[model samples]
Target: MPRLVLEARRIALTVQHGLHGRRRAGSGENFWQYRRFIDGEPANRVDWRRSARDDHLYVREREWEAAHTVWIWPDLSPSMDYASRGQAPKRERALIIAFALAELLVKGGERVGMPEMMRPSANRRIAERMAESVVLAPRLPASLPPPFAPSPLSEIVLLGDFWSPASEVAERIELLAASGAQGHLVQIVDPAEETFPFSGRIEFREPESGDRLTVGRAESWRADYDLKLVEHRARIRAAAERLGWSFTVHRTDRPASELLLALHMRMGAGGTASAAPKGGGRAFVSRGPA
Candidate 1:
């Protein structure tokens, strides 16, 4: 757990350096920008010192500092424990992303929380606190977060493979979106799951159910498998779009920073997810704000 926390912090720091400034005019203390004072505005709003330098009066604006609450959940189901070719397990990667995202969000003046685990907080040590909570919990969190309506002012982020039945996934999303909170669905997939590189006879096991299927030639199913995968992704994406939420698909082989940067941009843009260029087997789709 300690190691995971440390690694998450490292990744958070790395991404932090690459993030561009997101300053915007608001009621915050920090100066954001200065603009010519309008005639209708009160005289007290003008900055006299700046007006002295120029013929026109100027008004100083401060960056928006309102802290928003964001709930984050990473699936810890049995399936997340699977890894191919000695790659990092999906469970580990999910946890790392969750913790690192918490760190970044807190640093960016947002409150981060885990549904049913941790409450929203802006503590600087948010990542460590979350790790401790996970380790100390009596039992592991469920595959899906408990269904409850969060504050409409809050946003939610769910990270998982999302291999659950399409109906179930759609229903859960509907229940969460009922509260009108913005949401993000991040699908964490293993490279082998996408490629299905096996050719010879192989036995595929269902991680949660312990069901197994033996195939004489696994390569024969590649085309059908790919089609089903694409269809499933489309369904999930459709569900998110219907609710004005965002969906992002990321492969384990890709750098985690890529997803983080995309997510950061979406959140900083007022919870609106925009279409991102596809690259390195990553796909992002952000819908109009609710």
Candidate 2:
């Protein structure tokens, strides 16, 4: 059987004009609700057409639409190169998911940005252009808040292994949330990373830098490694809760579409298409209160 050709443009068209038309993400006045016209209400506030149709006085209450500036930041650290379970590395999986999300957000007409690690903008093309592209970073930027050029952030979606110290992300999230913008911290992880399913002695090498360390008993180190992984994930979850942002964990094994749906559920990104995380797999075993 011939395979169907898949493209970003096709995907965007489906999202923009398909079943998600009215609920598509974009900036404009959206219908909220209506109430009876009141004395103090502005003259223009009265929805005359509706009032005439209903044979009664009515006032329109609209929820002004605000453009969603989506920042899909992916951590390009060497640690993200691990790919034990699948053909693509963890980094590749992260990029694919990011692109799929960018497609959906931009298709809905949200201004999508992939700042420095790439670029940030409200243009769907910028995001679509990045779909299936490579992430290019000369070196890790200083572990400080990335300077969002030309302006500040209204929405942020951090996608990566997030191996950096949890404190850094916590601080960033606080700053982002305090800005009154909805933040979604999407942690892209690999199965091998969480489970440390490796056995026997092997030389571990940094995926980006190529630094290597030969461990005598990789299996014996599993307990300690798993403990630290859990701790790290816990800290991120706690920090997200503190900052009032939605936190989601996506495993590379799952389809990127599912991860996008997972995040949409938390942010109410759109309408009914926005549902709970799919697959229901254990991506992260978060501990403590979050």
The numbered model that scores best in lDDT is 1
Kindly report which residue pairs in candidate 2 clash with one another.
Answer: 111-122, 113-120
Error of 1 at 59 (Å): 15
Q: Residue-wise lDDT of candidate 1 within 1-290, one digit each (tens)?
A: 78888888888888999686444578877676799999899999999999999899999988677656889988888888878886798878888889998888877667888877888887989998899777776775566667977878778889888887666788898898897788888888777776667788988777766777888997897776666666677787888888888888777777887788778777734444634224333221111001
True lDDT of residue 145, candidate 2: 36
Per-model lDDT: 0.77, 0.57
Q: Candidate 2, 56: how far from true, in Å?
A: 20
CA error at residue 165 for candidate 2, angstroms:
1.7
The superposed Cα distance between candidate 1 and the true structure at residue 79, in angstroms, equals 0.4
Worst 10 residues of 1 by lDDT: 281-290
Off by over 4 Å in 2: 1-67, 117-124, 131-153, 208-210, 268-290
Q: How does residue 99 of candidate 2 score in lDDT?
A: 64
**Residue-by-residue lDDT tens digits, candidate 2, 29-117:** 65556788889867886888899989778977654346447777766556666666444666666565566666666545456666665
